[model samples]
Target: MLAGKRILLIIGGGIAAFKTPELIRALRGAGAAVTPVLTRAGAEFVTPLTISSLAGEVAHGDLFDLTHEAEIGHIQLSRAADLVVVVPATADLMAKMAQGLANDLASTLLLATDKRVLIAPAMNVRMWEHAATQRNIATLKSDGVLFAGPTDGDMACGEFGPGRMVEPLEIKSAIEAALSDGPLKGRHILVTSGPTHEPIDPVRYIANRSSGAQGTALAEALRDLGARVSFITGPASVPPPAGVTVTRVETAREMQAAVQAALPADAAIFAAAVADWRVENAASKKMKKDGSGALPTLAFAENPDILAQVSQMTSGRPALVVGFAAETHDVQRHATEKRARKGCDWIVANDVSPETGIMGGSENAVTVIDDKGAEQWDRMSKADTARRLAARIAAALGAS
Candidate 1:
């Protein structure tokens, strides 16, 4: 996906800088021509020789070097690449970029470059959660900057939270996405993911095994294609992409209201595993186990169907409506029937039976059913599926 692309890498000063050599190699291996820009402070963490050796080219550090400026100027270099990638995007660099400060060559290029910017932020957990960083990230996303990951894990500071740079492979994918033409650009897409937990009491509720991985990935992929994504998600195990506007809901009804509020979308993919039924009469207080000879009888009531509601809208209905089918038996048949009943354009069916292990699992095997026919895909990582689906969406949106 990154073939023939000129990737300008800006390495920031952080412990995460130790990962840049691998990133440089990853970019080159993916058939991208790499240009390394080392921040003055970045030099302390990783040697220029490492970057030069991996990229097979000399690295650039100083902004005022006469020889470097005379040939390929900083301004020109910044705008020359198809994409600008910031690895270990430090909190300082993020602040500078957000505030339009160009004291250094890196910041100057970032501000002056015409190319799309992709940032992989890596910092301490506290720093990441800090109000300033969050504010900067929000602003950057609003400004159309692309961000890959800051996966949650142990940090160099010896504390764990949410401030870790994404792996090189993930960044590579995001870069490919950035370089690709905006497929769903100018389109609005609404997607619901995860499992809604219906409260029966203060301490207990009904829930499903949905990881929200597929739906979250779909939303991110849509955003990568330049679509404006509005996400209505139940309590997801995983967080949604930073760029997407998300509304959190706990029950099927809450999700429905959130979806309806985000109307007039160009398309919607209902991937949430909404409960078919909730306790007809939920306990106002926590129900305790009392000395009883028999178990308590609970009555259930049906929940509203969100997909059908959105797809069957009389006014301002999206051009495309997509639904998900998670079934243990007769998967494709059920999905085909669902497409018609729900008034949707597509049904992405996946078997979540215990044997499939897809429920709350990272990998998935999906069969897409539409008016055309069913196309079953080999079981692969959910992230890969997201990429393939995003490409198809771009194509479809283009034709539409």
Candidate 2:
């Protein structure tokens, strides 16, 4: 898929940099040329000689090299690649990129580059979640930078939770996607997935049976079609896919806020099973049994109608807005009503009756409802369903 491509690979200073030699081989095996830039710190984990040997190109390291500088090699290197990829994009490096800092060879080349850049972040969990790092991430996304992963896993720091660099193969896939010229190229799609948790107390909340399989699959399908995907997900049983920007939220209110922040998208898909109501006066601490037969009374408030709000928007609305309806009965009628009531372009409805096993299952039977009416689809794997839906979305947006 990457034949004849030129990749400017920047290996950053992180333990994950040790994986770049393998990545270089993978890229080369796919018929791409790799020009490596080894950061001073990156050299601590892997030698420039090793990188140069694997990539079959001189691993550029010094911005002040007399011979290279005389010819403005940095400018030449920056503009020569089809795509620039940073493996183990350290927090410091990301901050530098976000701020347009060019104090070194890597940062300088990044600033000089006219190519799309894809970064795979690796850092301590706290650093990944730090407010400053998150701000930098938001800035980078706004600047049209692509991201692979800082997925949740056991970290080299002996800690866990969302700071591990994605595996080399995943990075390769991301590279392919970054360079793809598919139908959805240059389009930004917003996808909401999983089950929102509405807090009832410090330890208790309301949620659904949604496993987020279909949503995750759909996001990946759209990503493979070259769409820049903004994935706003709730607490899900399945992890969010790589190669997409992920915004994690817990409640319907939080999801609404995240969706709003990810706006100006070309299309939006609302697939989350958000709670309809939340405890109005949730306790600050865990509620106690008190050894009494009576149960604690709870007041409920309706959650925000995110689909309706976005669908009814008078301005900045997505060209296509698709919402999901998980029903127990009368699926078609209720979903049809929902499509008109929400003002969305389409409704993908499915029966989640316990007997159907579709709520948290691997397969789905759905009816795609629109102004043209319902089109029932046979049960299939969530991945297949996603591909069909994504194709439909591509066609819809393409025609519009």
Candidate 3:
């Protein structure tokens, strides 16, 4: 997919820098020409000779190389690449980019680049979770910088929890997605996934059995088709897909807020199984069993109707708004009714009765209901269902 693409690869100071040579090989194997830039701190971890050798290009360093500076090489290098990639994007390097600091060649190139920038962050757990680093990450994301991974795993610092750089293959996949020009290119799609948890106390909560697998798969499919996906997810067994902006929310209200924040989308998919009610007077502490055997009474409040609200928006509504219905009986009839009640363009209805094993299972049988009629799809893997749905969405939007 990346054939004839030019990638300006920037290596940052981090233990994960050792993986960049493999990443370079992967990019080159995909027919992308790599121009490597080794940071001074990155040089301590891997030699410039190794980077240059793998990339088949001279490793650039030193912003003040007199020979290159005479020709404004930084400007030339920045503009020459189709994409700029940062491997092992250190906390310091991220902060520099967030603040638009150009103290070195790599930073200068990043600032000067006209193309999209993708970063794979690697750092210790505490550093990754630190407020400053998180702030920098948010800043960079808002500035349109793409992130592949700093996924959860064991870090080189002998710690764990979301600071590991994803493997080379994953980064390679992300780069391919970034360079793709598919049917949904330039479209912004919003997807909500998982089961929202309505807290009853410090420990207890109300939730459903949505594993988020189908929603994750849908986001991945949309991403592969070159759509910029804003994925708002709740607590679920499945993880979010790579190459999409992920927003984590816990409750129905929080999901609603996140959905509002990711507005003006070309399409919106409401796949989350949000709790219908929340405890109005939830306990701050865990509710204990009373010796008197008197059960505690909890007041219930209706959760926000995200699908209905978004579908019935007066302004700034998405061109295509899709909702999901997990019904136990009369799936098609109920789904058709839901489409009208929610004011959504389409409703993907599925029978999730225990007999069907579809709710939290890997396979799904769905019927897509729209103004025309109900179109039933045979039972298939969730991944396949997602791909089919994504294709339908692409065709629908294209015709729109």
Query: Which pairs of residues collide in candidate 1?
Result: none
In terms of lDDT, which candidate is stronger, 2 or 3?
A: 2
TM-score of each: 0.70, 0.97, 0.94
Ranking by lDDT: 2, 3, 1
Whole-model lDDT values for every prediction = 0.85, 0.95, 0.92
lDDT of 3 by residue, 274-375 (tens): 888999999999999979999999999998899999999999999999999999999898899889999999999999999998988999999999999999
Candidate of highest lDDT: 2
lDDT of 3: 0.92
Clashes of each: 0, 1, 0
Of candidates 2 and 1, the better by TM-score? 2
Encode model 1's per-residue lDDT on 1-400: one tens digit a residue: 6788899899999998998898888888989999998999998999989898899888888888798788758888897898898988999999999999988878988998988888899999899889999889878866767677676789877899678887777777677656656767667788899999988888889998898999998888887887767777888899766555566689999998878777778788898999999998889898877877666677899999988988888998888888999999999888899999998888999998998889898899999988999999999988888878777777776788
Question: What would the per-residue lDDT of candidate 2 be over residues 19-49, giving only the tens digit for each residue?
Answer: 9999999999999999999999999999989
Candidate 1 accuracy as lDDT: 0.85
Query: C-alpha displacement of 322 in model 2, angstroms?
Result: 0.6
By TM-score, the best candidate is: 2
